[model samples]
Target: MDRKTKIALGGGCHWCTEAVFQSLKGVNKVEQGYVASHGINSNFSEAVIVHFQPEKISLKTLIEVHLLTHKSTSNHSMRIKYRSAIYTFSEVQQKEALSLLDEFKSKSDSNIITQVYPFSAFEPSRNEIQNYYRQNPEKPFCKQFINPKLQLLLQHFSNYVNEDNIKHTDQK
Candidate 1:
């Protein structure tokens, strides 16, 4: 069996981010919660720790999907609550994330503000809200905010997306 790896991501609503990662092929689990790094990012922010098999999904692909799914370029007012960050478990992971961000920055007109920080801690959300999207697919927030991100996954990362996890708009 392949060893599972983890990467913590935060940029938008935890519900939306959780749903997006949950729909991916290699993702074994997504721990929806608040995460905190060191120094300036000491305060917990909305995020999810994605557990996956690297052999099935590359870190670069995961980062790419994450960037595309959220407002990676925006330093919005709620940024304190929803930090744009990639929390890595190792120095290698941090370097790769930084390299990927730099590469993306060169191609896009807007700066990729997503920072790579060392993973420090994670506080899981309440059990009631753990799997928010899957549990409440018909919720207005799921339909309005999350569905679009799922659709984007289907459109651009179809090979990496788990189609079974996608609740089609017609079915909703």
Candidate 2:
């Protein structure tokens, strides 16, 4: 678990997910990209690839972070382009992911549609796309959508994120 485990996750739009993961304590990096494996079947889907430290965090925690985001803080871009997913790098991770999803559904108020499968090649998104929300926090999309999600993070999951990255704007 010393090495970072790569988890390919798509939670609607990559911009905000990148912003969100960048604020995490154990997430080494959140890569914006097109999952070539997913794109092979469709003409319109985009994705986010997350590389995180499993020693500092767990895949279950990663999934929880994504589920919380997609459930309560998403908009049309994610709805149309992104679907909740975990692209696994190993068979053990695959089993754990499904088990967690099943357990989560049983305890939750609503059903989840998170897709889990094996990993494949990905095309990295360009430099400009990385941390787009932070770069343009005042943009209409960031102000209205990503801001609210950040607010939710500040209000509720304050302990889970990298508090050093939390800004003055996060003050409530």
After superposition, the stretches of candidate 1 with alpha carbons farther than 4 Å from their true spots are: none
User: Which regions of candidate 2 are displaced past 4 Å?
Assistant: 38-44, 71-80, 168-172
List per-candidate RMSD values in Å: 1.4, 3.0
Per-model TM-score on C-alpha atoms: 0.96, 0.83
| Candidate 1: RMSD to truth | 1.4
Residue-wise lDDT of candidate 1 within 1-172, one digit each (tens)?
A: 7989999999999999999999999999999999999998999999999999999998989999999999999988999999999999999889888998888889899888999999999999999998989889888988889998998888899898888888654432
| Best of the candidates, TM-score | 1
lDDT of 2 at 31: 78
lDDT of 1: 0.92
In model 1, residue pairs whose N, Cα or C atoms come closer than 3 Å (at least 3 residues apart or on different chains), thus clashing, are none
